[model samples]
Each structure stands twice: as C-alpha cells, then as structure tokens.
Target: MLHGKVVLVTGAASGIGAAAARLFASYGARLALLDRDEEVAALAAELPDAVALPYDVADRDAVFAAVEQAAARFGRLDGAFNNAGIEGLGGGMAPTEGYPADEFERVLAVNVRGVFNCLAAELPRLPPGGAVVNTASVLGWLGGPGQAAYAASKHAVVGLTRSAALEQAARGVRVNAILPGAVATPMLLERGFRANPDFAEAAPGAHPMGRIARPEEVAEGAAWLLSDKASFVTGHTLAIDGGLSAR
Candidate 1:
C-alpha cells in the first residue's frame, strides 16, 4: 500500500484525480491535493493528513512552488499523480486547413506543458524509489473525429513519460502514464454525452468491454504504478480503456 508515503496529486478536486487522492489516503499516504478549485480545501480536510493547494498548473513557477511546499511538509516526495488536463473545445475536421490554432495551443498548454511543468519541478525533489504517474487518454493511441487537439496533447504526455522514465531510471524514480478510456466523470457529463439520446448506445458500444469505465477503475492502475509493487515498471503507458484501443 502507500503507508507513511507522501503523494501529490494534481486535478485532485474531481474525477480520476479525486478518486486517486482518496484511494491513496485510504492506503495511508500523506496526501497533497492540488487543483484550481478552492473546494479542494474542503475535500482535503476530510483526509487524515492532507493539504489542499489551489494553483494553476499552467503556471510553471506556481507549480514548482507547490511541489516544493508539499515535499517540505511531508519531509520527502515519494509519489505524484500529474493528472491535470483540459478537454479543449471539440472541433470537427474541417479539411485540416481551418483548424483553430488558439484552441489547439490552449489544450497543449494544459495537457502537455502542464505535465512538463510539474515534472520539471518534482523530479529534482523526488528521492530514490519515488514514482510519478501521468494521465493520458485512450485517444492518444486511437483517433477521434473532433478531438484532434486533446488526443495530440495526450500523445505528447505518453512521449514525455517514456523519455522521463529513461532519464530518471538511474535515480530509481519510475515514471508511467495511464491511458483511460471513456470514463464516467463530470467531464463526460459536462460534455453532455450522457444526456444525448445516441450516447447510451454509441458510447459503450465503442469499447470492446461493452461499457465505459469508472474513474475509480482507472485509479486502480495509477495506485499500482505508484506503489513498490510496480518497482520494475517505468516508461510504460498502461491502458485502462476497457479494450477500446485494442479494437
């Protein structure tokens, strides 16, 4: 489990991040919960020894400071869940010539650059045996009609994980990425997929498992990666996509 260890999780206010934070806490991790939402404070208060940090992951300095503070409080940095990301505005493939440049950039900033910022700050602080897990998406491997930007950002995250894992292997810091499929979370609800008449049939049908994933299910893979049980694992992207990518 994660007894006595300190784990920092970004996007800890909701969805998979929140689930992972709670799960880690249940396993006795001293949690540092980071999210842009001020509500993270209340959520953290429920845990035995958790600190909620409200900051924008897009801001490199702020992220660095947050990681430093977490390490200082816990006396060591053992693990981190770099799960902060944005879905971006869904856009159709309009001949590829008229894609919205700004929208694409914004998605990259949060999903790709955000991961980089956190890693840049956290890697130096992590002691030997430290582990880091990042959230990518099944779309990173597969393609989506109107999800080009989001998919590309996730693909970049996977690449970052592989490269960072190799670079940090000598230090005993394992880095891995999680590729989650259509998880039932607030983000999915906000996208209105659940309410759509066709969603019920089309969504689950996409995955070979015949169902969308729950956030907690994805968190399970994350927990394993961040634990000593996966000490030999690094630079790998574990797909928790209900066989979506396999199809």
Candidate 2:
C-alpha cells in the first residue's frame, strides 16, 4: 500500500523497526532508516532506495537534523514509525519505590521525550495525508510487577499519540500508537528474560494465542496504520498482542 512513498523508521537496526523497514520496502516504499546503532547502515545497504540515518532519538538536535536530512534525501516524507526505545535499566524489573530515580528519568528521556522530538521535527514536514505511528506497549494498558518506568513511558507515548492525532486530524495527518505484547526480540529475550528468569517460560501462556509475537507481526500493524488503507484511523491505540490485552 505504501508504493513509492517515503517512510522514516526509527530503531531500524533491529526488531520491529527492522521488520517494518523490510516490509515497507517490499510494499514499494522508499525508506529512511534511522537508528543510533551503526548496524542500520548495513540494513539500509541491503535495501533498494534506502538511506541510513545514524542518530540517537534522545538527542533533540540530532533527531531534528536526521528528520530534515531524511526529508531532503527522499524529497518528501509520507510516513513515520517512531519505534526506538529502551526497556529500562537492567531489564527494568524493579519495585516502584526502589526504581532508581535516575533510571526513571533516563527511560522517560528516551521513550517519551524522544518520541516528542521526532514528532516535533516530522509533523511540520509532512504533507496533508502523511501518517505517523508511535510504538507503545501492552503494559501501557495494564500494570506489571516491577515495571514502573517502562510502563509509565509507554503510557506517555499513548497520550502523545492521541493528542497528536487530535491536533493533526483536521489537517489530514493521521497519528496512532501500537501496543505490542511480548515479542521475540533482543529487548525481551536478551534483556528482559535475563532479568526475569521465568519470563521466557510464562510469556506464551500469558497470551491467549499461546505464543509470544514475532517482531514482524507487530510491524504489520504499523505498516497498515502508516499506509493509505487506514486513512480514517487516528488517535487509535492498536493492540498487536495476540489477545493478551483481552484478559
């Protein structure tokens, strides 16, 4: 559905962001893949008509520069997937009272402030029909044990998505958020699982689908939201969680 449109995907080096980049490319979209990881450059090299923008989303000036550079490279930006985020300090599983204040600040800076920075830079450059999708989490809806910082940041992301959607709806720009369940990504496997030994075993059963999601599954929802197919959809929180939230 994207066909020749230019889309900016943050966290494009891996996980859902990487999956989205490949999927969007398959749909004939030109890509601007942004990530702090240099691996993004390698991914961009593998795609046709793609540019790698290596920058950290937490850096406001850098994000603005990257967005401007992407638009300049592609001539116009048709859509975006604001997907870059960190779980929290050391897998982020900590009691709220004990959750280090610095860690909480760090998470907010990256997850909430980072998305804000991207939106601030991207919205003005988008045309009437341009779309944006922010990556929230299923935790944004439900609380988790020892997940205050991560949950709080995702909740903020949901608020940002809805508010931005309302602000831009009249201009024909769509903004939405995706709340994903446990996905088989490094963020979960290497970090989260390591922090909570039982997580890997219990995660599948937590979902009615009886399995954790693949990054591509979450990316699929984002792809449609960013495409013309969902033109009327805005301020919506899409749960790509295999029925986890149904409980």
Candidate 3:
C-alpha cells in the first residue's frame, strides 16, 4: 500500500510506534524511525530498508535537524506518524488541585510541544502528497478524573491536528489524528493498570468488542491515513477505540 514511499515514525522504539514501523515497512515504505532509546537502532535493524534516528522529540532543534537529515537522506519525505508521547507521572491522574507542577510541564513538553515541533519542522519539507498522523487518545474527547495534565495535552494535540490540517490541505498535505482507547502497551500496563489493577482485565468489558485493541489494530488506521488510500481524509479525528468513545 505504501510501496516506494518514505515515512517517518516517532516513538519508534516500542509499543504502538514499533508496531506501526513494522507495519509500514511491510507495506514497502522506507522508514526513518525516531526515538530516544538506543534500542531504536536495534528495532531499525529488524526492519528492512529502515534507519533508526535516536533523539528526543521534545528537543526542538534536534527535531528540526533530524527531519532535515532524514529528508535529505531519503530525497523526500512522503508522510509522518508523530506518535511520541508520555502518560505523565503516575498516569497523570492526580486531581488538578494538587497535580505536581514539574510533572505537568514535563508531560506538555513531550506530548504537546513535541507535536508542535514536529509539525513546524515537517510542514515546509513535505511535498504535496505528504500526510501526517498524530497519536491522540480517547481522553481527548472525554474526561479522565485525576488526569488533568495528560488529558489537556491530548486535547491540545487534537487541536493542533485540526489546525495543521487546515493549513496544509490546499497543498494536498493531509494531517489527521488517531484517538485510541485502551491498548495493551507498556505505558498502559504501568500507569493505566496501576491506577486500576483490574483495568487490563476489565477494560475490555467497557468496549463492545469484549477485548482491548492491539497496537497493530491502531497501526492499520494510521497506515491508511498516511497512504494514498486516505487521499481525501484530513483534519479528521479518527476514533479507533473499540466503541469505548461512543458511550
């Protein structure tokens, strides 16, 4: 589906990002995998025709430089899946009244500012056919008690995705976001499940599907949004939440 395309995926070390990277590569996309972990290099090695570029998404200058370097190396950038983010300290579930200031700042730095930084760096370099997929959460449209900071960051991402899509649409560059529900990931396991030990086992009941979504399930949506298959789709917040967001 993505044959001969050049795509960039952030947070590519593990979880959804890693899953997306592998899926995109399977569809014949040459990948530029970005992440802060050294393991990113190993993950890159596991995929065919991929290069792992290790860097923190929150580092504005580094993000710009890395995008430039990747585009230069590949000759052009076709699409991007800006999926790097953090759930915040303890899943950021603390009530607003007592949420730690430092943790709030750190979460915004990676989740909001990171997306802003990537869009800034990528917009000018992307050609007319390019597309971008931002990883948002079901929380963007709903409320999570005790998760004010994290929820706010995701809401900002949704706003950014919409505005960026408008700015790029006329040029044929599409920007969209995927709002996922409970997925079996490290972040979810640690923070989400920690908040509710039965969350892993119980979350599925909340969804109509009777099971939590797999990372690959979400990746399928992202890959389509980034591909020509979704040529007319833009400024859209696609809910791949197993019906959890419906209620």
Candidate 4:
C-alpha cells in the first residue's frame, strides 16, 4: 500500500516501531529506521533499501540531523512515525500532590518533547501529500491510578497530533495519532505485567478482549494511517484498545 514511499520511523529497534517498520517495508516503503540501539542496523539489513540510524529523539540537534539524513537517503520525506516514548517509574495512583516531580518531568521529556523535536525537524521537510503518525495511548483518553505522568504525556501527544494535523492539512500533509491499549511488549514485561506472576492475570483481564494487543496488531493501524488509504484522515486519534476506552 506504501509502494514507492519513503518513510521514517522512530523507536524502530523493537516492539511496535519494529513491527511497523517491517510491515511498511513489506508494503514496499523505502525505510529509514531510527532508534538509540545499534541493533537497529541489523534490523535494517533485513529490509530492502532500508537505513538504520542510531539517534536520541530527545536531542533536537540529533533529531534534525537524522531527519536530514533520512531525506538525503530517501530523496524525499514522505511520511514519518514518531513512536519513541518511555513510561517513567511505575507507581500506584496517588493524589497529584503525591506524584513525583522528577518522574513527571522525565516522562514529558521523552513523550512530549520527543514528539515535538521530531515534528520540528520533519514538518518543514515533508512535501505535499506526506503524512505523520504519532503513538498515543488509551491512557490519553482514560484515567489510571499511579500512571499520572505517563497519562499526561500521552494526552499531550494527542493534542500535538490534532493541532499539527489541522495546521498541515492545507499542505496535504496529514497527521494523526494512534491510541493503543495494553500491548504485549518488553515494556509490559519489564513493568511486571507479564513476568511478574502477581499481575500477569490481572493485566490481561482488564481488557475486554481478555488479553493485551500484539505489537503487530497496533502496527496494522499505524501502517494504514501512514498509507494513502487514510488520505482523508487526520486530526484524529484512532483507538486500538480492544474496548478499553469504551467503558
């Protein structure tokens, strides 16, 4: 569906970003995979005409350089998936007064500032008919105890997506965000949702589907958004939460 398109995807080393990169490449996109991990080079080797660049998305200068490199490699900037983010130190829900200041700042730096950095660097380079997809979360729409910082940062991403979409619409550069629910990823396992015997069952049970989403499933939505198939879609957050936000 993305044949002949040049695309850049952040956080392309593993999880959803990796899944999306593979799917886009399968659909014939010229890929530029960016991540902090050098392993992304190995991942890039498997795809046809793909380039992997190790980059810190939070660094504005580094992000600009990477975007320039991608435009140079691909000959144009057609689409981008700003999907790099981090869930700050996990903690139980508490009053706003009790939330850790440092944790909130850290999450914002990665989630909000990271998105801003990429958008600033890429927006001007995107030609007419280009598209950009940002990864939000179901938490952006719903409240969760103990995840205030992450939730707020995701909300910011949703806001950024909508505003950017409107601003870029007249240029034919569509922008959107995807709100994914609990996905079965290394991040989840690290957070004790899977590896921790105590929360494993409860985590899956929270979703209406009785399980977390697979990274590839979320990537399906992402791929669609980045393709011409969603030509008229923008300034919206497509939810892939298995009904988590329905309630």
Per-candidate total of colliding backbone pairs: 0, 0, 1, 2
Candidate 1 worst ten-residue window by lDDT: 90-99
Q: What is each predicted model's overall lDDT from 0 to 1?
A: 0.88, 0.94, 0.92, 0.88
Clashing pairs in 2: none
lDDT of 3 at 234: 98
Predict model 3's lDDT versus the native: 0.92
> In candidate 4, what are the lDDT values of residues 1-247, reduced to their tens digit?
9999999999999889999999999998999999988999999999987999899888889999999999998789899999998877652344567888987888898899999999999899998889999999998788767678888999999999999998999999999999999887777765636334656667777788888899999999999999999999999899998887887
Per-model TM-score versus the true fold? 0.95, 0.99, 0.97, 0.94
The numbered model that scores best in lDDT is: 2
Model 4 earns a TM-score of: 0.94
Q: Write the per-residue lDDT of candidate 1 for residues 56-99, one digit (tens) a residue.
A: 89999999889988988888889999998888764223223465
Cand. 4 Cα-lDDT: 0.88
Per-candidate alpha-carbon RMSD to the true structure: 1.9, 0.7, 1.2, 1.8
Q: Lowest summed lDDT over 10 consecutive residues: which window, candidate 3?
A: 192-201
C-alpha lDDT of residue 45 in model 1? 94
Error of 3 at 109 (Å): 0.5
lDDT of 2: 0.94
**Candidate 4, which segments miss by more than 4 Å at Cα?**
90-95, 192-199
Model 2, C-alpha of 187: deviation from truth (Å):
0.3
Show model 2 residue runs off by greater than 4 Å.
Answer: none
